[model samples]
Target: MQDEDRRRYHDLRPDWAESYIRLERAASLIRTYEVQFVPGLLQTPDYARAVLSVVHDDPGEVERRVGLRIRRQALLDAPGGPRLWAVVDEAALRRMIGGRELGRAQLDHLVALAERPNVKVQVAPFHFDGHAAAGGPFTILRFPDRDAPDVVVLEQLSGALYLDKPSDVEQYRRVMDRLCTQVEPLDRTAAILRAIRAEL
Candidate 1:
C-alpha cells in the first residue's frame, strides 16, 4: 500500500504499520502469481519463521512477524472469507526453504488448503511454454464493492509498489490469465504437490 492510500484508508480501519494488512483483510478476492516462494496467506508457521529469520537479525522481531502471519491465516477459514487463487512457479515448490522436512510439511499444508472451496492453487512447471509474467511475482487485490478498483502490488526487497490504474490492472490481469493457462489445472495440483513432497 502506498503512503497516500494508507492515509486515505486510515479512517476505514485504524491499524498502524503495513497498511496492506487492512486492504488484505478487506479484499473479497486475492489473485497471486508467485515465482520464488509460497504466498504469505498460505504459509505454515515453521516456513514463515524460516523466511523471516533471513531478513530480521532480532529473533524477537521474527517471532512477532510470524505470529502476525499465522493469525492472518484464520481469515481463510472464516465464514464467507475471501477467495485465494494462487499460481505458484514449480521451482518454488521444489526449493527447500526450511530444509526437506519443512518443505514437505509446507507441501502437505498446501494440499490441505487446496481442498477448501475458496482456495485455488496451481503450479507453473519449469516446462511451461511462453511464460507470460517474466517481470516476477505480483498480487492483485479486489474488493467486492463494484465501485472500488482493482489493485496490483509489485513487491521488491525494500518495499512494494501499489497500482490501482485501470490500464495497469488490466495488463496484469491478462498476464495472470495467461499464466494460468500455462500452469497445471486445479485438479492436477494435488498430484504435483505429492510428487514434489516425495522428492523432499
Candidate 2:
C-alpha cells in the first residue's frame, strides 16, 4: 500500500497511529460496533465526505480523509483479507449525520456490502431491550499470527485505547457476543436496511 493509503487522523494521536498499524496488519478477523454513525469501513464516499466535513473545515483535509477511508475499505476485498463483522445500533441508522439523501445512500451501501461472503452486518433495533454494549462503540481485532493476541479498541474523544489484556479482550468479546444475539439476524438485515432507506 502507498504511504498515503494509510489511515489519517487530524489530531495525529499516538494511539490512532499504533491502532492503524494493527488494523492493517491483522490477518484473522475484524469486528466492530457503531452506536452513532456508520462504520468507517462501510461508509459511502458521499457519506464519508459529509461526515468528514463536520470535523474538518478545510476542503483539502476532508478530501484526504475520505480517500484514506476508502483505501482502508479495500483491505476487506484483498485476497486473504480478514473476515469483517459489524454490529450497529438501529439508532445509528436513523441519525441523519449526513442529511437525508446521503444517509439513504449510506444505508444502501451497507445493504450492498452485507451481501459479501466475508462481511456480516447486523442491526440492534430500537425495540431490543437490555443491551450488553451500553458503553458505546468498540472494535475487536484478531490476528492470524498466534503470537499476536486479540486487541479491543475503544475510541474516545481524545484518542483510542488498544486493550490486549486477556481479561479485557474477553470481556469485550462477551459484550460483542451478546450484541450479536440482541441484533437482527443477518438474513433480515438487508430488508431492514431497505425499509430504513425508504423512510429516509
Give the lowest summed-lDDT range of ten residues in model 1.
8-17
lDDT of each: 0.85, 0.84
Cα displacement (angstroms), candidate 1, residue 145, comes to: 0.3
Give the alpha carbon lDDT tens digit for every residue of 1-200 in model 1.
Answer: 34765464444332323656877888999999998889999999999999888787888778777877776777798777789999999888888887999999999999999998999999998886648888899999999999999988887776678899999999999999988887798899999999988877
- Cα error, residue 103 of model 1, in Å, equals 0.5
- After superposition of all CA atoms, the RMSD between model 1 and the true structure is 4.9
- Give candidate 1 regions above 4 Å deviation: 1-17
Q: Evaluate model 1: give its TM-score.
A: 0.90
How many clashing pairs does model 1 include? Answer: 0
Per-candidate TM-score against the hidden true structure: 0.90, 0.92
- lDDT, candidate 2, 72-190, per-residue tens: 78888889988889999899899898689888888988988999999999998898776899888999999888988898988887678889899999999999998898778999999
The per-candidate count of clashes, in order, stands at: 0, 0
